[model samples]
Target chain A: MPAGKFTQDELDQIYAFAVDLGRKAGDLLMERVEQRIDGSDAPQTFEEKENAVDIVTQTDEDVEVFIRDAIHTKYPTHKFLGEESYAKGESREYLLDAQPTWCIDPLDGTVNYTHLFPMYCVSIGFVVDNLPVIGVIYAPFQNQLFSACNGRGAWLNEKRRLPLIRNPIPPMPANAPSQCIFSCEWGKDRRDIPDGNMHRKIESFVNMAAEIGGREGKGGMVHGIRSLGSATLDLAYTAMGSFDIWWEGGCWEWDVAAGIAILLEAGGLITSANPPDDFDTASIPDVKLGSRLYLAIRPAGPSATESGRESQERTVREVWRRVRQLSYSRPGA
Target chain B: MPAGKFTQDELDQIYAFAVDLGRKAGDLLMERVEQRIDGSDAPQTFEEKENAVDIVTQTDEDVEVFIRDAIHTKYPTHKFLGEESYAKGESREYLLDAQPTWCIDPLDGTVNYTHLFPMYCVSIGFVVDNLPVIGVIYAPFQNQLFSACNGRGAWLNEKRRLPLIRNPIPPMPANAPSQCIFSCEWGKDRRDIPDGNMHRKIESFVNMAAEIGGREGKGGMVHGIRSLGSATLDLAYTAMGSFDIWWEGGCWEWDVAAGIAILLEAGGLITSANPPDDFDTASIPDVKLGSRLYLAIRPAGPSATESGRESQERTVREVWRRVRQLSYSRPGA
Candidate 1:
């Protein structure tokens, strides 16, 4: 397939548009929160998506519609894929192709938003030829904005270049888990089926958090375990090098498409969250937006003995060895 | 024993001094982080506290000394209890007494600070009559300041009143766990002994996170579980009503003293993290500053049939029924 092409001017225009739209959407989110806090807005009403814990509020729907309308008005020819629209069955088929497409998660941490937890964001990504190339994410609660494109390095609020460590990014630790601050999610999948996603996720969390020598050598004894309840923020934090690793499963392309672009631009690595059947001969697998599983590591400093990529790969492989094999797929796939 | 008495003017002066000191300490923390990020500061050096996962840095000790010196110069007669002093054996005996005492954790979330994860803060707490009477917590990274004194309501940044809900705080849900956002910690303890702190903590996390109606009804199915790696911030957020419930074990008095003061002033409730042997007859136990285990809930709005305290207690009792009884004591206690 031919790669979708865009001139330098066009790419710059798209990036600017995404950033402007993200900030505007973030403003709308802030307005809603403030209104609710002051009792100006009525109590929020929500509907369950997959179960009781997986929810969708009217603001999510409103924000998606707002973004879609603005995008359609500005770039009438561009195709768009958004979480709320997809959930509503407006897009019945997978939309990726060798074309320019906009993927968006209007409110990435809806649960956090509903609970006023201050970690939610507005994520917007531009994809080209099935690759995430241009990304913009705005977390209004923190007033943080992350943006990146294919070749240009990522930035925080359009000023500070990421991995945020202007110094040489430190190399991954020799014993990865013992020295790594890892982030993961207990996603919507809550089933207890043996070896299923939830069961595997719980087992993986315990293994990573257990003593270094206990649990029959499966203990990761990581520096810390954090669950921010938002994959977008988790990936963004990883891109900025605050979190050294992020492993996630059972989320949609819109949930991570933008974060993946920023992370890669920050010189990070992305691979399948699941390990290979045999590590002796297999290289780490690449992660696609639709894979529904991913493992991300921050940019590593190059050492005399190993290149940055080599160190990252070694760390990924070590982590893979300690975690359970996880499986997840899109609904009805 | 007589209660330590303070004139209203004295209390007001103390509160102002604490807030000023906290901000100054926070500024120092921010300066250090920026220096390290810009490669202008020397690489951080740390000493392991309990094990590899628990660490202390020069900044923690430096900040503590700075605060202690300032307190001594201004209030020479007042006693002081701080994390670094106790760790260094400066004050050998337990100092909680009916005296005007200042308890401080110079840099809470030291691990996150070292990693530049941006959840750290300076915590200054004042105790009188063996009670946390005035509290000030400053998170410079986010520029959030939480302060409170007895009688006067809590404030965020000295402007917004907390729970931050001016109208009325929402009542606890009837089925508590299913609607609560819980904050917990995977602390320095990593022992996997049967029913040990680590063992019980992991089990409780899994139980609360599992699907409802799973594992023979032990599944709590809470809305979300967040581990911020900072008990001080956890308690502060709880005081602000951002987190509905925070259950913590194996933390220090300096870690929670200030936060406890703010939480109580915000109309929240604090109790033991452990459940009693007989729920039918036992009342929820009160949590002391050095209890090492605590369960806190947000301020509940009164309902037709139940007052705010009753609602909070009911919710606490329900959560207690779902979690395992955890035991933790200070090392060599």
Candidate 2:
């Protein structure tokens, strides 16, 4: 093996380290949660970034630093990136080189964590030359540990194989619009564009298929739209078929790298939320993990029958079409 | 005790019975889930009532019948009200008389169950006359059992006290609109109303307080909006301070009956989702539990200080105001 370039065996070792590190980090975070629940401390002070909804607490910083130090002690020359320290010196350019980089989100759902919502998680993604090679996501409250290496299949708690591969990859919906559960996250960006703001886009998107006086061919009227306040878990569970569709953006690379590995291994597909009209899957075989825009679909699950596969394809196509109709573009996009 | 009413011992026995029965019912449902994962059965058929979202599968009926028979054999005089049996000459009127009765949702969050959302549960509520006297909710996947008997206090797993109540009764949020976590459910009804529809109302409600760029005061932008798909667990967790405010409607009485008993014991408050402008809490200390529209707020926890008390009151007032602003109404109302 080259001095700087590690083989797949080395990558697997790092993935092991990440799984343990993530579980420990998750324990520290949940300990603080218990503290908050016990009223051991007064209300926490959170520093707002772009908006009130986009805030970070001290635990987030502390957890990130701990993870960074731990990684440094293990791999001195390896680069590390975290959400809290993104701009100090580290940037995407650091990930552009042919070196192993550790992309970590010490806390993916900060808002959910502070509010005592159970959807928060610890996400760590190890990328090689900007390619996500291994991912780990730990949801403490749910006691779920999801991890995947580039080629190895995803696992929940390191036991069961995912997609459980029942009928197909993503579980087919018994029915769409009314019987399917979809996931949507209201990201940190509260900016309003010419097309529509995030809030506006969500309202319109929900109204399109929802029963608005039986509005004809307008609403996706999906069984429901759920926002867990955590992007990593959203992708993780979507990969496991907890949700049929997951549409997310306005977050950075660290938030999704680990999830991307898991989702792909679980047989789910990812595409640009806003794709060109004649989008060719053959050409765009992979989604730009750093572009900050993503639409994910779980491959049909065990419920998907030989007959249902045809309908599932049509539904996936229609959902992709609707994603385009929403026209939600962030300033960065 | 009166002729038709039970003594304290009788109530205790009934509560114990419900808890055990609920756990067993939940187990059966989960076993079926495992069977599906192991590919042991053909696709099950579901019957739709009002719409596709309003569905009931054979398992629901089977579970209801099992519970009903057990209760009937134990206490033949006690009436039973269940979702699967509601249309067969059963109604809240069965619960209106002074006779002891059982109100049950054999499987709550049915849609979640079918889609493997992991938020569904088995809720069994026991009532005397019109009052919710005993409540039990079992989440099989999470292995959580929440139960409460009036004035007996609530227990999770029959061990720990909930809210852990740190400050006072319900923990006060640092800010109502920006720091609180809220729960909202879209029921089975998909009718488009004159002023948009339930789907539109929900979108507006979520966006009104959700973070939107430059929308100013129009958006309530509360910390976030979450939907559990199961009214029972939503109420059970809200009672435990997992959710700050839970606004729900368009479901039946059995859905919220068990939650009502649990929330009241937790020192939480529930009012009509749309309260009259001049509604006086001093005069009407207790909310009408049968109302289809309901809004619940958690009381400060064991840490509730005099200063935190004031903030808790303010946040509750603001959440109530938002509920009224949304103008959510029930078909019965």
Candidate 3:
């Protein structure tokens, strides 16, 4: 009944089970896609939520129900939190409280799925005492499986270390704007401009891309921005170093839990996308899903010299400052 | 000795031959990429032109030379225009003047290729009397070959009729802002905000993405924007219907020649990104490579009803009207 009480064998078993379940679910996704290649697969079964721009389909729900049932039947005591079950307040209760909590997004990047885009995936994670202990993300389209267990290291296809590229790389110039490859997405919350905040969100999005220091340019002008439409792949790719950093907000805990475990297990750093000035990225453990933000940094290459990590830190710090106001800071923060 | 003199069979023969050359060159590109997988390929052999953001690699030069030699040896009477030969004003002489002209991009999306991003490709176009008679764009990563000969319809992998998704699709809702998926890229020209035509370019970019209809939202708040980092893939994907629309300017003629042929052959329509009043989407013949701007639309579905094409044309017209001032016209035009 204590935090971190599970033995190493127990952790490994859970990881193996999750990987199997995730992969099976991923296969199910692929099968449905293959069956519907004609643009006529259960077209009526798709529904829009929050906004027509956001969508969910029968496949998403079917896969979630299947995974939930399998994991619950196998480990009934484990608290399960999934995207489909978000209305049940599953996202808010992150405390593991001596029992394991399984966090999952049966199908992340639902919009991309509807558009037949290639980056959607199945993300599964196991948490204990509010800490993600096991993670597995399966991108079925590309047949890529990214996984990691706490303290056991990370691997792709059960081989090779995390951060596809080795360390000792050069830093982005200054905030390393044009040299940095950043990935972010426009979530279902599009009313931010007219109904909610005073154009902070859209303005921020534009600024990050505007001329570095021009009148309307408050953004970092990074090398590029990818709206890959899949948070799970975004994080999985970041964990793999396919992407340098991923900044996001307004997504649920399950959307990032699995990928976060893989990221941190591989020695990557994460925090609120809009952390405070005193925020120490090294203290990633303090960050919580409730923050409604996820800013993940790739690990320095394995071969990077000691100074390599230092340079990356400086760059990350500068980026943090530039994006400090990204979040809707609660009126008078 | 007249314009448009080539027969359908001649056009087809040229098409078949260019596909072969493009694929061969794509294979050579892959070989070079594999050899430099470790960020070590011709590391210093890259030279910048115009600016540091615009670069030329050894592989680019090598591929251009190889294609030029092969084509010249076989068709000594043809006038060949290539990116590598741009310094000699090869791009300026667009007039066909009886002799056939081969316009080729040895390497398109050089930035993505150098970054190993996997979206770059080789684009080859053949023109007879100023008409794009044959086109081939080969993307080696996905092994997808897109080709179009003037009258012979466009094909992907020589099979599927393009604009990947069949359409008779609904138009974007009035507030349909985020329902439309659009793509635009940030090219090497960063000074477009300063030294250029008074920030018209950046302002237009900001407008398209601005909060839909907000006082600041002068643009279509489309579903999302993707900067895939490659023009060839951008056009290739546009041809495949992976993207609904693509808007670009300032890129070389060779950059679009092949994709343009494929787009037209596929029945897709293209016009300047910002056309004059009374510019007809149906009159695509008036648009030329020298225009320096392109706005391409996805075509109706292959099996679309007669009304389907009309609906598509309507949508294109609306989009064009909304984007009338996209480019900075010289003074008052």
Candidate 4:
């Protein structure tokens, strides 16, 4: 499908459908919230083989199944890649080919939901030949809906267009230290491996970020570090410039698929843990899994040439170079 | 002043005064927001000082002066310790004495304010003989007011009591790994640091935490780390049980003064960065300056026996031991 082949009316219909589905999911979540509040349902109850953490509630399964069924029934010709159905040894061919496919994560922050933290969301992305061209993220808790359609620009809550902030980011003084904030999982892998390299890499990254951004050198210290426990929300916050930089490891594609589209559309940059051979859409999948690292910098004004996008890229690369060699091994490995 | 010395009527008046002051300061901030939105006033600007981040805003100074003046004029007998004045060499003796004194950080989380991040607050605490007996923290952006009296429970918005979660925390399994979360400043002190030991400490903490909490560990890994940028709000959130643990260095007493009172009142614990010390009222100070560290933990569940506290204490000690030997030295050092 060529870029201009989709007419404006078709795009509008798709946008409306996506928004409706997002709202439907949010409404279901609200219903669940009411059930929990009314004691009609317990949010989590154990079943055999699945730990409480591993168990997906009926809401999770039902929501995903509903979306998949609805989409497949409505658009039988379209391909689908969803979180719940992907683990049955399905091939990635749909995503590999240049066909239009829907990538959906019914719930982006599941732990938050289990704990009732109110930071979770429903994420949906439309990909053409593996490239995200339409993104919809609905955070029911915050009543925030962020959507973008390639060249149409992004919108918050359908009415408010997200005008990109174009303020000039002051040039970071030469020799000025830089700061970094990274997020990683505390997976259940501690026991089998006594020596943890992830620990070393994190230590190195924090130390270097602080050192470069701290007081002993020409640059001021890095601002600080934060781990919010939700990748989608983290990426969303980063895209809005509430945070300066975000680095991460050990996250799945669903965790970042919709967020990646939003981040890229917002003019933010995303790259692999290691420098990419080329900075383009193709680099996304490689950077999505936990195997690769990601460095995302919020967009800055072009007038501040020295410390603009290029400078930020160089700074990130330098920070990566300083800590890249630190080895990390999984416990069993 | 003894607990019963003040009549119920007098106590009511004091509460009213504190609440009014908080609201007034909040209104001033709201005005600033409107002005910024209307393009009538510029957002607060931030500058880097020697290893420190500084924000110069009329709101901060104005709010501080307004609070101090109102207190002084109304209760001239009461002593006051505030941030802006302290920077100009105010005495710490007032805070040390047993007399009723006020500790205030008119604009907590100034960095958030400068960046329009919506996490800043106005914190006010009342201490009699160094024991924080009253606390009022108001976050205008979120319209949240966290308040508490010595014997009374904490409240948010004067209606909802603290510890919003209704469910009991699950028991800690015997096989549970040692996992923790910490919050700290990336102070403006990077200029003199050469080796980036601070970064190393962060890497070490994150790695250790991840290893202990990550996959392959018997017990699940620690949840994650977060930095909200304001000690007052951080401590308040801890008191609310939103975060299990908090550790911070490079902040002042006013920042944590009110929050400390609220935490203790809520049955949480706090100690200096050194081995776990008593978190009794006597141990808290009125003002803490550069190079101080703190550890705060919300009380564990009924299942946590004396042995459980002891085990948790030992783990914390081990973490500190690893962290203590590490330091980020200035470039020349």
Top-DockQ candidate index: 1
Please rank every candidate by DockQ, starting with the best. Answer: 1, 2, 3, 4
Give the higher-TM-score candidate: 1 or 4.
1
Q: Alpha-carbon error at A322 in model 2, in Å?
A: 2.4
Evaluate candidate 2 and give its CAPRI docking class based on DockQ: acceptable
**Candidate 3 or 4, higher TM-score?**
3
**Candidate 2 interface RMS:** 2.9
**What's the C-alpha lDDT at position B60 in model 2?**
86
**What are the per-residue Cα lDDT tens digits for candidate 1 across B250-307?**
8888999999999999999998898887764588777876778899998778877888
Worst-scoring 10-residue span by lDDT in model 3 chain B: B324-333
Residue-level error in angstroms, candidate 2, position B39: 1.3
lDDT of 3 by residue, B1-333 (tens): 222777777767777889899999999998886555455544324677765557788889999999999898988988988887774453344443447889899988776666555567899998776567688888786577788888877878787666544433333233423455566666655552553532444445445555555434455656556667677767777676556667777676788888888887766667777655775445433446655677776654422333535544554555564553444222111
CA lDDT, candidate 2, residue B145? 85
- The lDDT, on a scale of 0 to 1, for candidate 1 is 0.85
How displaced is residue B281 in candidate 1, in Å?
3.6
Model 2, position A294: C-alpha lDDT score: 74
* CAPRI tier for the interface of model 3: acceptable
- Could you give the candidate ranking by TM-score, starting with the highest? 1, 2, 3, 4
RMSD (Å) of each candidate, 1 decimal: 2.2, 3.9, 4.8, 6.2
Q: What DockQ values do the models have?
A: 0.69, 0.46, 0.30, 0.27
